[model samples]
Target: MSDKRTVLVVEDEEMLLSAVSMEFEDAGYDVLCAGTAEQAYDLLRARPRVDLLFTDIRLPGQLDGWDLAERARALQPDLPVIYVTGYSNEQPRQVAESVLVMKPYRMSAIIDVARRLGVG
Candidate 1:
């Protein structure tokens, strides 16, 4: 087992996922990349030590990022989430201890967030 803090990134776009995964990895996190809420749930359930969640509001499946965060919170209540989307004006509701970061964001900003959250 590795000591690197784990961050689960749920994004539908392949390019976005790859880019974000690389950013997190470079920031020293063990990133778990998933394309859907269900897949994210599986990764979250399987890995008890996932330190943070950086997910997109929209996803590939029926369940959205909110659902993913809810399920993940059930497994790990203290999980810190950052929702990334293009429409930052449409504020999210019922999010627990989260940050809404707009898309077209600097990857370095996300890395800074992870560091602040103590996730690698």
Candidate 2:
């Protein structure tokens, strides 16, 4: 296992996925990239030491980020999650208090939030 903190980033868009994953990796984090919710779930099941989850709310699968977060919490209760979404319809009630970054969010803001949440 790597000594660096690991961040699992789930996003459907290819460019965004690469950009965020690269940023985190450059920041010294071990990044696991997933293009769909299913892939994210597979990673969660396979890895025992994920330090953070940064998922986009709208994914190309049955489960969205909120659902993924719930499932992840079941496996690791204290796992920190930062949700990214373009829709402002209604923040999922369950994760209302958690970090939510809008679509046009600056990457630095997300990194700052993760750092505050104890992730690298």
Candidate 3:
């Protein structure tokens, strides 16, 4: 077991995922990268502890970020979520202890949000 906080990041865009994962790693978190919601869910089930979920709203599979968060919350009720979307028209359905952030956001700002949500 590690003392570092863990964050599972889901993004279809390879560059974006890498950037976000790197940022979370720089923030002292155990970063898990997934390109789809299904992969994220699998990690959620396999991992005993996941401190945060940072995911893109529009994913490849049937389950989007919102569904992914809901499912994750079912497994880990207190999990914090951060949903990102580039599509201006797309809106997030509310989930407890979660925040929706527009695309092209600052990584530092995300880290701050994670900290506020009780994750290091």
Candidate topping lDDT: 3
Query: Residue by residue across 29-95, what tens digits does model 3's lDDT show?
Result: 9999999999999999998989999999999988999899999999999999998998868555869
Candidate order, lDDT descending? 3, 2, 1
lDDT of 2 by residue, 47-72 (tens): 88799999999998799888898888
Q: Residue 114 lDDT in model 3? A: 92
Candidate 1 residue spans exceeding 4 A from truth: 89-91
Best by TM-score: 3
Cα lDDT, all candidates: 0.86, 0.88, 0.92
Please write out the lDDT profile of model 1 over residues 1-120, one tens digit for every residue: 898888899999999999999988887888899999999999888875788999998887788888889888889999998888886555585466788788899999988877776666
- RMSD, every candidate, angstroms: 1.4, 1.4, 0.9
**Sequence-dependent TM-score of model 2:** 0.94
> In model 2, which range of ten residues has the least summed lDDT?
90-99
Ranking by TM-score: 3, 2, 1
The better candidate by TM-score, 1 or 3, is 3
